[model samples]
Target: MNWRIETKKTALLLIDLQDKLLSVIENRERVVQKAVQIVKLAKLFSLPLYISEQVPEKLGTTCKEILEVAGDVPRLSKNTFSASPILPADIPKNILVCGIETHICVRQTVYDLRMRDKTPYVLGDAIGSRNQIDHQLGIEEMRQDRVLITSVEAIAWEMIEKAEGAFFKEFLSILK
Candidate 1:
């Protein structure tokens, strides 16, 4: 299958990256930092941003930094593991996914997206779980469903190919 990168046709879906959930994930800080970068790049490139909290009352809010970068993008609150059914139906095209508890929320969302015929790409480094085993298992599951698993830097650069120009320069600065 051909993997095409289209900024206008993509949305970044951040799943259950809340304080409670994040606290238990391994490499929490690193994961959040990478997710922040992804959010910044998404804003710079004009890609739509979608965030979900798995029952925010239980999981708490997504990190302040992430929420700040998210700006006006409405955050969806869901009791279900998959946010697809809750997300606005108008959001068409591929999704760039990142967040905590990869084996559960992440895997479920990817599966839902696949079932709905929407292309879902997991941002590998930007996702985390309570342990390494579950994280690896989540990625494997996503792969089995034919989801494109990739990294933030790779996806960002793919959206901004050339190393020069204003967009590229701004993107580089954000990455720094």
Candidate 2:
């Protein structure tokens, strides 16, 4: 497990960020905004990306903002809280994770990924819960389990790794 994010070896996973779920998340707007930012980062850096929907028939698909920027990334439909089963076996071992219902789907997926020996860094700003307490505690619990907790900006800088470069310039443009 790498302590720092290596862009070539990492995959971005956005789980259960559906319309029905977002409608109740306390930080819905921020979550959507960060999700878009992360998706753009994935595109700019050419990182592999996956978006999981939890029973989309009832919950609805991933939000349009993310999908619009995500381009052709795989969108998985699953009944399980942990998206591990649906994910392709060949995906990168280092995962940047974000999505709705932090305590339920997001938390469970992080744990399941760890069990599979995959390193999952949960983006704090991109995930949400219906209640603030649940969101905070869920993050705390994941921290206790030794999962890396990060923000979208932190990971973006980590991947970029320097102040000067074409990638960094594009990253700045995306931030605007």
Candidate 3:
């Protein structure tokens, strides 16, 4: 429930960013752009990054844009809507999540994270769905139920603290 993203203690949990899933989201390009930014940030901060594909055999692999930036992050392939079971028990306390079809995979994962007593921070701008109303409703329910909802810039700035030196400048330029 901490508002700030403690870089060393947080992990990025990307849910169902698979091919078929991304194709139907409302803002695929925009969500992918933000996810790429987070992938770069996670690497820069040395935070663990995990991705899941809901039945990769059926939905297809994660989109190339995200896969390209994610480096060697672990990928979970399963039929489950929630990616929790596949996640390692030793993951960081703060889990930053984003992905397509917010009402299903994303929503279930957050709920499971809560049940597991892990703190989940859902990235608002980085999540999308074919039905925008469902996406919004999913977010609202999670927020009301105590899951922390946030934006990439909010989490990144707190992790960065201030825009100083070349690294900050470089990171800031990535957002442009």
Model 2 regions more than 4 Å off? none
- Candidate 2: tens digits of C-alpha lDDT, residues 33-147: 9999999999988899999999988889988888899987778999998988888888898999999789998999998888888899999999999999999999999999888
Candidate 1 yields a Cα-based lDDT of 0.88
lDDT (10s digit) by residue, model 3, range 1-176: 56667887799988888778788788888898899888888877788999988888777898899889897777888688888989999988889999967888888998998888888989989999898899899889888887878888888877887778988887787666
How much does each candidate deviate from the true structure in C-alpha RMSD? 1.3, 1.3, 1.5
Residues forming the 10-long window of minimal summed lDDT in candidate 2? 1-10
**What does candidate 2 score in Cα RMSD to the true structure?**
1.3
The order of the candidates by lDDT, greatest first, is 2, 1, 3
Regarding TM-score, does 1 or 2 come out ahead?
2
lDDT of 1 at 53: 89
Of the two candidates 2 and 3, the one with more favorable lDDT, higher being better, is: 2
lDDT of 3 at 145: 87
lDDT (Cα atoms) of all candidates against the true structure: 0.88, 0.90, 0.85
